[model samples]
Target: MKLNKTLSLAVVAGAMMVYSCGGSGSKTETTTSTPAPAPAKEMTPEEKHKDNPDFVNGLALVKQSDCPSCHMVDRKIVGPSYGDVSEKYEITDENVERLASHVINGNVGVWGEIPMPAHPALSKEDAELMVKYVLLLKK
Candidate 1:
């Protein structure tokens, strides 16, 4: 009787240990990919447009121009976020021109090791519009 009681207690303790350690018979070491950094602020639909008429129009142009295929409004995709780009430049005529030029001719080294493809089809006016739209995301 004593030996049987000791064996039973050992079995119960062993089972408790196993249960405490997570009783999933097989260990699954799952590693999830770390997502890119999120934007610092919450965005309302109104925040996207603000008071800029050009940016409002250019927001539509951004979709038509296939910008979202690489860039998102907030987070990183293949390219940096529009918010990230907005953070890169200050509001000024010269900065706008530079951004427009980059959109038309394509720029390398600004983003990362990968180069941005040249948007030859994008007109100068449209490029300016897109730049303005991107810059509007700052606030």
Candidate 2:
């Protein structure tokens, strides 16, 4: 009777271990077989900007830089919102030129006394994209 009880306990313990290990191993296999879904795609540059080369270009330029750390499309932050600037200078070539220059050089007094830091390394073409995008917002 004593030997039979001991054998029964060992069998139960071995079965528990096998079950636990099997459960965990199957979970790992399921995870390996199933990949997470991909993220949603952003709107195309041309569709979003709609033939406004400057805005499209500007978006690319801004993304390349650290500007979004402080600026947003519709709301205030450390700087004027992109929408406000767009509205302020819509339909004006001069505004495009001026704003583009400001991006490369940075601006003070326009948003406030808190001056934007200059990025002189940013090219004229890249700056123009920002200006164009802002202008589109005006519409």
Candidate 3:
């Protein structure tokens, strides 16, 4: 009787140990929470204007042309800076038309003796868009 009782207790304890350890081929799942994402950085003036159709199209036009070879946004290089041009000319319809004409037909004695080369290949509409982009660079 004593031997049987001891064997029974041992079997019950082994069963309890296996059950506690999840050894019955059952999967146990544990959940962990993920951290939230950080806030977005503030956009600059140029970035803020990215939504504007003229700004986006004009910037793309300028990038695809030789404008960067002579012109820049803030400082003068071979020609006047875009910011300087922007400050010198107001954002008027007449100014846009005049600047676009100058871009396509070329201009002399404007910024200096260095004449702005004519982009005869550029369409008037595209030239106007480019001018609009430059005019937006005002400090």
Candidate 4:
């Protein structure tokens, strides 16, 4: 009887240890964490105008023309920057065409006492392309 009681007490103690301390038969807990979101992408001139052939043509045209001699993309040089022109006007089809006309016809007193010379040689289509490119140069 004494031996059976001792064995029963030992079994109870072992079962208690297993229950309290989480033995091999017990299930292990798991956790999952969410990751941070990716940052937003900034658009470049190339990216913004990638779908338009005119934008590509205008980029090439500006390089060939004396447009760079007077104007710059970001800041003022001789004439206003492309960015400044973009800021002054809303970029509609009408504004683009009008600005293109101005590019070909040239103007004075609008920007300053300094005059913008006419590009009589450039085609209307090409001028419009150039204007489109310029308008996209906004900050």
Number of the top lDDT candidate: 3
Summarize candidate 1's per-residue lDDT along 1-139 as a digit string, tens digits.
9999999999999999998897767876679998989878877645756676887888879988878899998899988999999888987889999989988888888898777889998898888988888887786
Can you give the TM-score per candidate against the true fold? Answer: 0.64, 0.60, 0.67, 0.69
lDDT per residue as tens, model 2, 1-139: 9999999999999989988778546554534466778888777534766666666666777877888987888898999887787677765778777887988898899878989889898888777777676667653
Instruction: Kindly report which residue stretches of model 3 are placed more than 4 angstroms away from their true locations once superposed.
Output: 1-43
lDDT score, candidate 2, position 31: 41
Q: Rank the candidates by TM-score, best first.
A: 4, 3, 1, 2
Best by TM-score: 4
Write the candidate numbers in order of decreasing lDDT: 3, 4, 1, 2
Candidate 2 colliding pairs: 55-132, 55-133, 58-129, 58-130
Taken over the whole model, the C-alpha lDDT of each candidate is 0.86, 0.77, 0.91, 0.87
RMSD of each: 12.5, 11.6, 9.4, 5.3
lDDT of model 1 at position 23: 71
Q: Is candidate 1 or candidate 2 better by TM-score?
A: 1
- Model 3 earns a TM-score of 0.67
Off by over 4 Å in 4: 1-38
Cand. 1 Cα-lDDT? 0.86
User: Candidate 1: where is the Cα deviation over 4 Å?
Assistant: 1-45, 48-51
Prediction 3 global C-alpha lDDT: 0.91
